[model samples]
Target: MPATCQVRVLGGFGVTVDGSPVPAHAWRSRRAADVVKLLAIETGHRLHREQVMELLWPDLPVEAAGANLRKAVHYARRALGGPGAIAVDGQVLALWPDGCLDCDLERFNRDADTALASGDARACAAAAARYGGDLLPDDRYEWWAEEPRARARSRYVALLRAAGDWTRLLELDETDEEAHRAMMRRHLAAGRRREALRQFERLREALRERVGVGPDAETVALYETALAEGAEPPSVEQTVAVTLANGLVAWGRRNVEEAERLAKRARALALDAGLGHELGEASTLLALVAYARGTWHEQFRQEFADSVRRSANLENAVFDAHLCFQEFYLYGPEGHEGAESFGRDLLGIATAADSTAGRALAHLLLGEFALLSGHLDEARAHLDLSLTDAERAGCLSAQSIALERAAETQVRRGDRRAAAALLDRAMPLAHSSGIRSHLVIRIHGLRVLAAGGLVEALGAVRDGERLLAEATHVCDPCSMAFRIEAARACVRANDLGRARRHLAEAERISGLWQGGPWSAALWEIRAELRRATGQTTQAAALFLEAAELYSTLHRPLEEDRCRGAAGVR
Candidate 1:
């Protein structure tokens, strides 16, 4: 059998044969090693004799170079264990086609190319891990190796950037100016302004220490942007407005306690400043928090009404859009037509303002509404548009939301496999963008539903429940829906205790915030739990109620399911 040979050029140069390192003396002839390196990296592992001579023995006379090439080939063959390892034709030299040769550089390039083509970030990261350093680091000053070294370095850097492995990229080369800029951009995009500023400072210091110069114009501009964004509030009213906006963001992420605190602060500030508009926004945010907490406080309802009245009297298009969104939450399930109309109005306003984020939000809401109404095609169309806008704007949070909702549409359309794939794609975006726990919880719940077998589904539900418990403030409608599904899974697995607990939680939430389209699901799960516990009369009544609710909601499939469960004609 041919001797197995392995060549490694990244970080340094080394060769092994038959699982043992080649003897040091085997590479004593530097020219022979160079010849082998060139052939191994070259396309098809073949190069003409003249090219090799020109590269290695460039300054020698043609006859002398020819003789040197012949001697180097002889040494390379011996080092590789025999003549069969190196093939020499009349004017060309190459590695033997059938020989046992494993080259790290070849493998790295192949892996990188495949990953880049597929746009698989994890695969790209794995490929990038193979790049220990520049090609043949020991051959730093070799003129013949300069171009290939630069090429390899550039490819590796590109792979790291594509994978969003910012920390790893910095570890590989802290002095890389582009990597610094990329990191700053990523942090800023994820709303980590302070981190972006800190990264810029680190880059500036590194550049000044290593090269005695500050960052370039673009890097400096990016730092300035971060600084401007992080600037202190100019006025009390403006500060309160900012606080209210931040609270809204926290609420979206299901951090209800944090949102409540921030909203209270904003309301106090606005009350002191007597800024009606700011106070209105603050009140609206507080109401949103109350809703997320499943409390449905009387104060929340009064505040929501006051905010809507105040916003309607104002000329702020953005505030109007927000108010419209609040209305959707307030009456969406009970008034689908009105909710859809509000969605269209928001879309129009967003488009008029040329706001990608606004447009994406409108599309997401519309898509969700359509999905709830059983308009699968319309849901998909809206979701696709939202995804396009979100991606174009580099809105990672929006992209994750769009993808998660699209996955639900697929699941409802009976394509669990496609839904699973969509969730898989959404997960990285969710992590990178810091998506709210409500969305993440729903994503996990969908994954549980998609998983085959009672055991696997129960395992997923348990894991998701653990995560949900960690986010204690999460009490949104999505959370209620997830609880209902978890209860269903528990029933499927014959875990009556757990199923009852989940069903009770769902019932409590639905009772506090009644009349939503999801109330039907809550009722259906309660019926299932009752049926499992031998409460036949109560189960039948609950099933009939669920069927009535589904029928009112115009959800034919769910209505039929509930009717079947209730044994109705």
Candidate 2:
């Protein structure tokens, strides 16, 4: 029978053989470490031998791979105290049944996920305590291992901070003896003698049993004096911070309406507390939300500038810069200069700060500008940089936008097939993350489909109508613009009947927006629809109007196309 093994690494790195400490050398070789790490990550699940072989020797030929794999297993067994400690049969291996070890990284992952999923503060704290160091710090230099290690480190940090936040909430654990001790001290200061004395004894007894320690000299001294203090504790200045955190979560979840309200409250509280960082963050978030909702560029720019000035903190400054770019992009077609300036500022700030999130957002904004300006290489560079950063950071929302920008660049480069593949890859990430930019991605998806002529006329029309309906529901100008581009793509596919339906929706949105470059493009599509249906006179007049609008917007290529439609080019 195999000896039982207990592997433990949750609080610290150690293993127990039949409830006894096993020396670290018992697990030998980089291959052994790799196997243990991978299996431990999956907990009780079994990894097929082929899978392990492929992971460990991704470049090896099959014949040599099997021989090396066997040698690795042999070495692992010898290092682990012999055949009984590590058993292998065919493609399956199992640790000794009585084997046990401590794994801090594993514990951190399990408990941290629990805390995040359930908002369990206690679990988060436990996970934080377990996360003593990075995953196999001894292996940090291994390039292939850095991604998983970094991910584990980030999760632990986020969970620990969240737990600390909840610990301060009072709602999570009001009966916390620490809170009682705090309450007792406050009561003593407020002249509530009996109440102070009672609270002090309660805390002292609780601490003696739980912590094996009595009240400190200061607390004891307060209890000795009676009628000195006991009133409701001073306003803790906690609400604003809590609300701001909640607002951030809400925004991440794409609940923009709630985020706006919570952020406003946070801002009000920050003002009262004179916390410039919180004030700036809340205000900048509000401005971004405003931009997302199609608020004017001048208004968002003013607010963004004010927030940056208020905080002057790196993160908040980055937020302000990103919001400024987004605002310029969404409003005033002629305001490309603002977008360009903000993108430049963001890049400089991101480089100086060296924050991955900041750099990714800056790249995303710049990529958008590059696409609009028809700089294909520049667009690809920025979009790829953004996507790489976002993917590394596990920021799915940012990654989705980066892919969307890349897809647009691909389309401009006349690589329609590549654009479709890019959209397909990005859509699931956007949807699963519940990102607010799902609307943006979906609109782009429609463009890809229309450009590829993947669906016949009726089917394409139905899909376009459905997407436009959703885009209109969001009432976001950026989303509406993309949807209009999708409509133009459908017209190019020679789906004129379907194009007219999309054109009507575009016309309605244009009327609401008072017309822009997007609206002018939609008019060109409308002319195409009219011509396809043999309404030549009406098409000619509409084409001339579209040319005029495109010329006013300085889109010469688009204006030329519209003029050619009117037979004047």
Candidate 3:
């Protein structure tokens, strides 16, 4: 009822009824609550007076029913705390959007519609999460209340799942027996079997205590089967969903098999689904898995070709464009003309489609390429655009990733303090969103820490190792990245044996990954390690190889590093 009223319908129908919070003493009648609920759920705050009278007094004669409806409206206004809350305009009864009644349902509905139109999961999740619980739980028996209830429930289920907020969903609706069962299936789909069973048990106990009933048959059976199986790995589809999330968990651990398995499964699923946004998710995840393992070139070519051939809808088309930008960043050259060209094409399409994720992605990629190519000022502009869009869209994972990349660029250009501050802001957001790419960023952050002398004497070394270990556990590990940092950390610690081992591993992975900005750095790092370990001949050979690769790739900074490491500076 106040200006820009706040209503949260998701948890329950909570409303600021006419510029005031409905005090406990005010909600004395179910009919009064029902009246407000009815009008709030109507389209455009408009409802017919005759229809309301019929609903409130079905069997009364017309004259008596009219009297009853008027009385009900009067009392409802009083309960809402003012006469200004509701007014009759001839044959119509309406709640003013700005005055005595603001409904969360209306806000949720509006946000959900916008998100659905845009096909952005984060926006959808934010909108859907506003629906706290059953609408008008205090007046659930009213027949007219079912429509808003159903709409809220459906949106919650769809958006929560899409946003991968399984734990939150379970928490919000543990006693909703149907939702509990559905959550089990979702957890299983996401490859979280333990969590699935735990949720089911919680629901079962809650149902038992609250209503003297066990879990629904479907929920019980799912629990039984999953328990009997004793924690098998997730299904291919579920595994793919998790792995597409970026990097493996834990310190210096990678789940290469799982990442590969999930990507493969996603591909199969995509093929079966065909021509839709879901299929595009699969395609993009596969590309990400490829990029994570440093084998993106061939996969990128294949996916780009496939995307160009497809005539999908706006959502799917935009997703495909996002994939191209990611590919260009990971596999294309530094200050990559190719990436920039592809990015322009993709960004244009995303703009036309009004795809928030696509636009954020394009900006992030373009910024990263620009930064690597010595265009730091341009990088800052693009990265800011990326962060702004990501924040507005509520895509925390995308936002964190962009921030981390931007922080790296900042650190490289004598802005160490700013870079650290960015990392601090980004870490929690990244962890909450389950974004594995943060591992790579954190490792880079450690370099800034060492350079800034902010870390303990051996802190950076230990932290670097831990991050590398986690990266390995998730997929085909970023073995080269792990090695480059591990080698540097070890050298700093004066551990020559470990340093050589790490350098050797870096060399192996670099050879496997072939030419790229990162791989070239790996080679140069290996050369430095070799030179430090008194393997002068080997160091010269590795440095020469690295320089040749860097020159071919037009990366003078890296070529210079290789020459310096070879003692030819």
Which candidate achieves the best TM-score against the true structure? 1
* Per-residue lDDT of candidate 1, residues 109-170 (tens digit): 88889988989999889989888777886666465776888788888988998898878777
List clashing residue pairs in candidate 1.
Answer: none
Among all windows of ten consecutive residues in candidate 3, which has the lowest summed lDDT? Answer: 243-252
By the lDDT metric, which is better: model 1 or model 3? 1
Q: After superposition, how far is residue 99 of candidate 2 from its true place, in Å?
A: 81
Better of 1 and 3 by TM-score: 1
Better of 2 and 3 by lDDT: 3
List the RMSD of every prediction in angstroms: 20.5, 18.8, 24.8
Question: What local lDDT does model 3 show for residue 424?
Answer: 75
What TM-score does structure 1 among the candidates reach?
A: 0.47
State the C-alpha lDDT per candidate.
Answer: 0.71, 0.59, 0.60
Off by over 4 Å in 1: 1-335, 534-538
Q: What order do you get sorting by lDDT, best first?
A: 1, 3, 2
Is 1 or 2 the stronger prediction by lDDT?
1
151-196, model 3: which lDDT tens digit per residue? Answer: 7778777777666676676566556666677777877888887888
